[model samples]
Target: MNFQNRKQLIVQTVDERGSVDVRELAELLQTSEMTVRRDLVQLAASGLLYRTRGGAMKVSLATDQFRFANKTAVNADRKDYICQLAAQDVQEGDILFMDCGSTVFRLCPFIRNKRITVITNSLPVVAELMSSDVTVNLVGGEVDKERQAVHGLMAEEHIARYRANRAFIGVDGISLQHGLSANSEKEASTATAMARQTEKVYLLCDSSKLETDKYLYFAPLSLFDVLITDTEAKPDVVAAYRKAGIRLIN
Candidate 1:
């Protein structure tokens, strides 16, 4: 492979495995170990990855959040279905707050032409809605580059500035006991802020997230006004949220 193709190959490897060793790249690209080292060095210098003892670890984006490329591929069809279900609640002229998550990103296309004002800190959501007539307000703060979402004290402060009719949030996990959790502390903070500013909070999660717990806890099940999930959600999990007075939609 040529130099350019070799570099692209290196990136594709990291995207697939989340990390790659120099020796593996050497074998795969039919290049010398020193040449692979050079490629790794170049990629690391360009902010593509971080070199470790024998390999490179995909640079953990924004400290704790996974890269968008990593997340955009998982449970895509389920996310699309949940988004379509959630969009049914959104009517024209509504002022809503959409939180960051892959599922919420899928809701963007269905939102076109809706006379709504969307306040969000998710860069992907903002980018998807940029050309639409919907008034989009991006709560600015420290950008979590890997997740491409904004969060921190500044983001929370901005979220407090507006009251929304509905807030659509997603979580890494939810359980009968733990409620909702997030993979990153910043995301938990941002989700909490979004939940607080809205009259009603709807947790949009896929079936895979049901009964799952991650690194950070966000809120109790009672906090969410509704839970929108895919049909694959476990019946017991659905019952748990329902028992907490959280309406369930599949």
Candidate 2:
């Protein structure tokens, strides 16, 4: 397998087994132990795993919340691709609502040229578009240090005052049964509020989030008008989503 595929496999194996030994990974991958060690180091550096003396362990899901910096590193390529597609939905003079989700934050750089107004709660989005031509209006509220975004009743009230032509958001998990969910209630509330004020709701997520449900359910599947994801999304899930009348961009 290629480097990207091999690294993905390593992450999947570690996630499924909770931990993996170097020798076992090397044998399973049909590669040398040196290569396995290198892959483990790379994944560890990305905050996807904890590197050990002779193996690697998956990061503890219970304690490891989705911090902005860490989320940016995970599925970096896929997020970029999804952002590329979502950027096409933007137009000149459009008023957009951007949620604080990591995947939705990727849209900032791609949208710099568009003469649009951005209402956002994300610190990273504000910083990225501050010097660009796009106008940024930050929602006021208490900042969540780990999330690097604004949240709370103040932020939700701020969102309610404005209506946008389109809103781009992200979620920690999405499933047919559980709908859209997030690990933090604050983030979930902010995302839901943004969606409520927009005419069109576009969800920017990677395939990993498909068929998964997190701690809090914020919105239903019908809240989203379009789902922008990478080609890696599961075929069955994509078909099911399409059947449910949600537009899919893969």
Candidate 3:
């Protein structure tokens, strides 16, 4: 194949699998490994992919220097602020259930120094806290590649076996009218399971996710003990949530 075809194929592989292996690309294109590396360098320079020691990763996956690729990268600063607010609720020696939501993943950094145990279904969460003071228990189940988490009947059952002091979760949309909804039912089920076994549930969402609705409704607003969002939340909207008896920490 020509150089253009090889380059396109390399990009396609990364887009499909989230990362590309240099050896695999060389074999697939019947080219030298050096040639593949050169192409990866150009792609990385163009911001199409990120070069790793062994391969190239999707651009979004490199946003946080993690394995999971999330669209929340667009509003990264806002999400970090939101998660920092949520992290305040965590105390030492607490058992927590962390979700796969990008917003929830942001919580890892803030609480890494705390002495606590975390039960989660997110692969990114595991990678984030692997070298930290927090102990991680990953739920076993079918992998959801797009979300970079695990969710299924097995995952829900696994979550049921453990109880936590707090559960930090994310949602596609959350509002008083629609409650909590998600674009993926499998993910919704995992969230429900986590909340069910937790003493308190904190919903970590940004302003854009507030006052919106998705198709699959999972839990109601009543399930959450607190809603932590960024400063972008409007005064009246914050008041509405407070009036509904849901606490807000911003």
State which candidate has the highest TM-score: 2
Candidate 1 lDDT, 131-174, residue by residue in tens? 99889999989988878888999999999999999998888778
Residues 154-189 of candidate 2 have per-residue lDDT tens digits of: 999999999999999998778888788876788888
Candidate number that wins on TM-score, 1 or 2: 2
User: Tens digits of per-residue lDDT for model 3 on 1-250?
Assistant: 8878988899987876554568668867999999999999988898889997667777877775423455545367878999888888899999999999888888889999999999999998999999999999999999977678898999999999999999999887787897998867987998889999999999888876677676688888887888889897778889998988888887
Q: What is the C-alpha local distance difference test score of candidate 1?
A: 0.81
Order the numbered candidates by lDDT, best leading. 2, 3, 1
Q: Is candidate 1 or candidate 2 better by lDDT?
A: 2
- TM-scores of all predicted structures: 0.73, 0.78, 0.72
Query: Which runs of model 3 end up more than 4 angstroms from their true locations?
Result: 1-68
* Ranking of all candidate structures by their TM-score, best first: 2, 1, 3
Global lDDT of each model?
Answer: 0.81, 0.85, 0.84
Clashing pairs in model 1, backbone N/Cα/C closer than 3 A: none
- TM-score attained by model 1: 0.73
